[model samples]
Target chain A: MARVQLENVTKRYDDVTAVEDVSMEIEDGEFVTFVGPSGCGKSTTMETVAGLTKPTEGRVYIGDDDVTTLAPKDRGVAMVFQNIALFPHMDVYDNISFGLRLRTFSDDEIRKRVEQAAEIVQLEGMLDRMPDEMSGGQRQRVAIARAIVRNPDVFLMDEPLANLDAKLRVHMRTELQRLHRELETTIIYVTHDQAEAMTMSDRIAILDGGELQQIAPPLTCYNEPTNRFVAGFIGSPSMNFLEGELIEGGLRTENFDVELDPGAVPGVGVGDDVTLGVRPEDVHLAEHADSLADHTAHIEARTDVLEPMGDEVFVYLLLAEEVQGSMEEDPASSPNQLLMSVTPDTEIHEDQAVDVVLDRSKVHLFETATGDALVHGLTDRSDQESGPTATEAE
Target chain B: MSDRHRTDGGETRTDVLTESHEAELDRGPFQRWVDDSIKNPQKVYRAMFYVAAIFFLVTTLFPFYWLLMVALTPEGQLQDIIFTPNGFNPGAFVEVFQTIPFHWYVFNSFVIATASTIVVLIIGSLAGYAFGRLEFPGKVPLLLLVLVISFFPPAAFFIPLNDLFNTSFFFLEPITGDGTLYNTPGAMVLPLSAIFMPLAIFILTTFYSQIPEGLEDAARVEGTTRLGALFRVIIPLSAPGVATAGVLTFIAVYNEFFFSFLMTDGQPESWAPLLEGIIAYQGQYEVLYHLMAAASIIGVIPVAILVIVAQEKIVSGLTAGALKE
Candidate 1:
C-alpha cells in the first residue's frame, strides 16, 4: 500500500490543458474517488497518478518515490480501463496471470495468485473461457482479477463499473467495498457518478474544468461544501437557490421575508443582494397560521404536479401568476413556488393552494455575483446546525 | 314470412359463393408453388448457378485444352480438327531437353524469382511498417514519392540500370576490379526487386495500419520495448496481412519477364531468360510445343498453391479490417 501525492501536477496537450494544476493527497490504504462530469480531467488525473501520462509540470510521489518520470509498469500500479481491456486472445486465467508472468514469477506462484484473484472476484468457473465468451459483468470481474493478481501498491480504475447494468453495478460496488476491506490496498477510482463517489470513497475529490474544487470525506463535503460548484454537484435534485436581498428585517424576497441568524448575516447591511439556498426536504407545508408565524416566510402556492415517491410526496408548486399559465411553462418556477417533501399520508391535490414554510436554519446564503457561499465559518458550526449528514441524505 | 325467407335464401347464396372463393384461394397450385419458391429460392438458383458456372469454365479452358492437344500430337499428325491424338509420343519432350540445358534453365529461373521475392518481402515490410506506423519528417512526401515511383514504367530504367551494372567503380576500379552484372542472375533479381518494391511497400503499409493502437499501449504498459511490442504483438496479430504481401510479391516476382528478357540476353544458362528458351525459343529454331505447355503448366502450380494456402491472409489484408467481427 502506498500514499499518492500530486504536487501541483499539470498536463497539457499542445494548447489545450487536459489537467491544470491538480494537487491532492491520497492516504495509504484509503479508497479515494475522483468525481466530475465528462471532460473534467478526472480520468486524466488518475492516469497521471498511474504514470501512464507524464505531467508537463510538477511532481508525483508514491510512497516517497518520485514516479513522475517512471513508466506505468515501473510505477508499481495496475489499471482497469473503462472498456475492461482484457486481452481478448487470452483466457480468464491467462489474463490474470499476464502481469505475474511479465514479472517472471514461477509457474506455481503465478497459478496460485491467479486462482486467489479469481476466487476473490468469484470467477473460478470462468478460468478456461475466453474474454468474448464472458458477459460484461464477468469481463469486468476478470479485469479486476487481473489487477488484483499483481498485488500492486496502488490500484487505479477508470470508470470500471460503467459498462455493467444498474443492478450489477450496485452488486459490484458492495463487492468492491468488501474487497477493499480485505486487501487493504490504496485504490484511486475515477467516476462521474456522484453517488458512487459518496458511497465508495474514503475521501472524495471533486473536479471541474481541470481544477480541483474540493477534497474531503463524503459527509464533510456534503454538509459543508467549499464553493457553489460543490454544493450544487453533491446532492440529488440539488440545492435550490433563490435570488434575493438581505434587507432590514431579515432575508427579503419580493414575495416573502425570512428570518436569519445575526451571526450568519455578519457584515451585511440592508439592500445587499444574495441568493438563498435550501433543500426541498427542509421546506415544510404549514397547515396552521400559528405554525406559520414561527417561520420568517410563509407563501401559499398551488400544487401543479404531485410526484408520490412512496416515502415522501414531492409536490411541484406554482405561485399565483405562474399558475394562470399552464404548468408546462416553467413548471418549477411558479412565482411563490416551492418543492416540499411531506408525509405520504398527507393528502394533496393538483391546483390546490397550500402554505410552505421555509426553514431559515437550513437555508444557505451565497454572494449573488460570485456564486461563492456567504458564510465562512462552517468549521466552527456544531454537527446539528450543518446540513444533513451524508448517511441521512442517502 | 316471405321477406324473411327471401333474405335467408339470398344470404345462403352469397355465403356459398364466398366459401367456394375461399376454397379456390386455398387450393391455388401456382400460388402455393410461388410461395414455396420464395421461401427457399436457393435450391432452384443453385442448380442454375452451377450450370452457368460450368459453361463459363469450359469456355475459358477450351483454348488451353486445344493448346495441350497440339502439344501432344505426334510430329507427323499435326493437322486441324483432330478429335483425339492418334498416338502420344515423348519425342517433343526429348528434343526440347536435347536442344538446351532445360533443367539448369528451370533452376536458374527458380533462384531468380525466389531471391527477388525474399528480398522484396524483407525490404518491403520494413519500409511499409515505417510508413504505416512511425511519425518522421517528410513521411507524407515520401509516401507520395513511393506511389509515384510505383506508377513509373519498369522498362524505363533498363538502359540506365544496364549501364550502371556494366561500368566499373569510378575510383576503386584498380583494387575492387571491374565486373559486369550483365548475363548474370543479379541483373534480373536486382532490377526486378526495384521494380516490385514500391508495390510491395504500398500493400503492406495499408495492411499494417489496421492493427489497433490499444494493443501497442497495452504492450508498453506491460514493460515491452517498442521493437519488442512490434514483433511480439503487432506482427502476430497482423499475420494475414504479411502473408498477403508475401504472396503478391511472390506472384509478381515469378511472372516478371521484361527485365529478365532484356538483361539476361536470351541465355538459357542464365537464371531468367531460360524459361523463354524452353517455351518459346529453342536454340532460335523451333518452339517445343509439348515441353513448353508442360513447363508453363508446371510453372503456374506453385503460384496457384501459394494463393490457395494464403487465401484468407490475402483477403483480410486487402480488405484491412473492413469486415472485422
Candidate 2:
C-alpha cells in the first residue's frame, strides 16, 4: 500500500472545469472518500488518482513516483466501477483472475489468488457462476474480489454501491470496511452519499463546484465545517440556515432577535449581513432549553409539517409570516423554515404554535456575502478563551 | 332488488334498464370478440399469433421445400403442381456431379466466401470498435461515409475494377502473374470483402457500442491494453453481433453471382462460383432442370447450416440494445 497524493491537480473538459487545483494527500492504508454532489468533481479527482483521466495541470504521485502520465495499468491502481463492471461473459473465477491472467501469471498462482479473494469476499463456491446469474450484492462482491485479487497499491472505488438497493448498499458498506481492515490497502472512494462518507472513510474530502471545500475526519467535518457549503452539505435533513444581519448586541433575523456580542464573531461588524446555521437536532423546543449549556431566547414559530421517523420526529416550523413572504419564490430554501428534531414521543402537530430555541454551542455563523463560516459558537466562555469553540477551521 | 324497486316505485323503470342492458350485450360476433378481448385478451392473442406465425413460416420455407421436391423428382417428370416427388430417385444428386465439375464450384465458393468473411470480420471489428467507442473529430461524418459506400451497386464499380485488376498501376502489381485477376479466387474474394465490409462494420459497430463502457475501463485498470480489452472482454460480450456479421457476410459472399461471373471465366477450373456453375446445367439445347435443382440444394446446404447454428445469435444481435438491463 502507498499514499496517493494530488498536487494542484486540475482537470478541464474543453470549457467546463471538472476539477480545479484540488490537492490532498491520502495516508498509506487509509480510506479516504471524496464526497460531493453530482458533477461536483469528486469522481474526477479519484479518476486523476487512478490515472484513468490525466489532469490538465498538476502532478499525481503514488508513493514516490509521479504517476501523472502513467497508464492505469502501470499506476498499480485497481478500480471498482459504480456499475460493478464485471465482464458479463466471464464466470466469477475468470472475472476475479482477469488481472492475473493479463499479466500472464501461472495457472496455479492465478487460481490460488482467485480463491483467496473469493473467500475474502465470501464468494466461495460461486467461481463458476456468471455475473448475470448473480444478485446485485453478489455481483458487487465479485467486483470487489476482482480488485482485491490484484493486491494493487491503491483501490479506487467510484460509487461501487450506488447501483445496489438501499439495504444491500448498507450491508456492502460494512463489508467494504471489513475488507479494508483485513487488507490494509489504501482505498480512495468517490461518492455523493454523505452517510457512506461519514461511515466508511478515515477522512472525507468534501468538494463542490470543482473545488475542495474541506478534507478531515467524518466527525470533525460534521462538528466543524469550514464554510457554509460544507456546513450545509455534510448533514442529512441538512443544517437549517437563517439569513440575517448582525446588530448592535446580536443578530436580527426577519422574525426574531438573537442577543450576542458582535465583537465575539470574527470577520463581521455590526450591521453586516451574516447567516445563522444550526442542525435540525440542535434546534430544541423551549421546554428542553434547560438541558442545553447555553441557548438562544425562545423564538415563536408555527409547526408546518411533522415527519415521524421512528426514532425522532422532524418538525418543519415556520419562523414568521414576513419571512415566508420574502422567500416565496424559493420555498424549498425558505429562510422562514426551521427544521427541529425531537424524540418520537414528543407531542407535536401541524399548524401548532410553539416556541423553539437554538442550542448556543451548536449554532454557526457564516458570512452571508461569501458563504464562509465566521463563527461556530456565539456563547461567551471567558475561561476557555479558544476564540471559536466549534470553528476548528481546517 | 324487487323489494327496493317496489319501495321506490321503480319496478317498470328497472325492467326498461335491464332490457336496454340486454340489448347492449347482444353485439355482433366481431364486436363480441373485441369485448371479450378486454376481459381476457391472452386467449385471442395466442390464436392470432399462432395463425400469423404459421402463415409466415409456410411462405418463407416454400421455395426450399419446392426445390427439394424438384431435386427428388425422377428425370423428365418435373410437372407443375406435383407437390410430392414423382418418384424418390435420388440419382439427380449424383448426376449433378456428372453434369459438370459442381464439387469444384462448391469448393471455390467456400474458399472465397470463407476467406473474404474472415478478412471482413477482422477489419470490420477493428473499425467498429473505433467508431463505436473512441472519441475523435469527424467520427460522425466518417461513419456516414462508410455507410455511403454500401449505397453503390456492384455494377457501378464493375468496369473500373475489372480494368484495374487487368492492369498494374505504377506502384501496385496485378494480383496474378497473368497481369490480371481473371479466373482467380482473389477476383471474387477481394471485391466481395470490400462490398460486404460496410454492412459488417455497421452491424458490429452497433453491437460493440451496446457493451457497457465501464467494462472496458475495468479491463484497462486490470492491466489490459485497449486492444486487449477489445479481444478479451468487448468481443466476447458482443458474440452475438460478431456472429451475426460473420454469418451475413459469409452468406452474401457465397451467394454473390454478378462479380463472380464477370471476374471468372465461368469454368470451375478457373475458380468459377456455384451460381455460374449451376447455370451451366443449361446445355446447348435442353435445360437440365433436375440437375440444376440438385446443384442448388447442395449449394444451399452450407448456408442453411450456418443460419441454423447462428439463428439465436442473429436474433439476439438484432435486438441487443433495444432494451436496457
Predicted model with the maximum lDDT: 2
lDDT of 2 by residue, A1-394 (tens): 9999889999999899999899889999999999999999998898888777889999999999999999889999999999888887678898999999888689999999999999999999999998878888999999999999999999999999999999999999999999999999999999999999999999999999999999999999998899989998999888888889987667898788776767778878989999989999999999989998888889999888788999999998888854443334332246778888999989889888999999888888889999898887766542244334224311
lDDT values of the candidates? Answer: 0.74, 0.87
Clashing pairs in 1: none
DockQ of 1: 0.23
Task: Give each prediction's DockQ, rounded to 2 decimals.
Answer: 0.23, 0.43
Candidate 1 local lDDT, A70-96, one digit each (tens): 877788788887877766656788778
Query: What's the number of clashes in each of the models?
Result: 0, 0
In terms of lDDT, model 2 sits at 0.87
lDDT of 2 at B43: 86
| lDDT accuracy of residue B257 in candidate 2 | 79
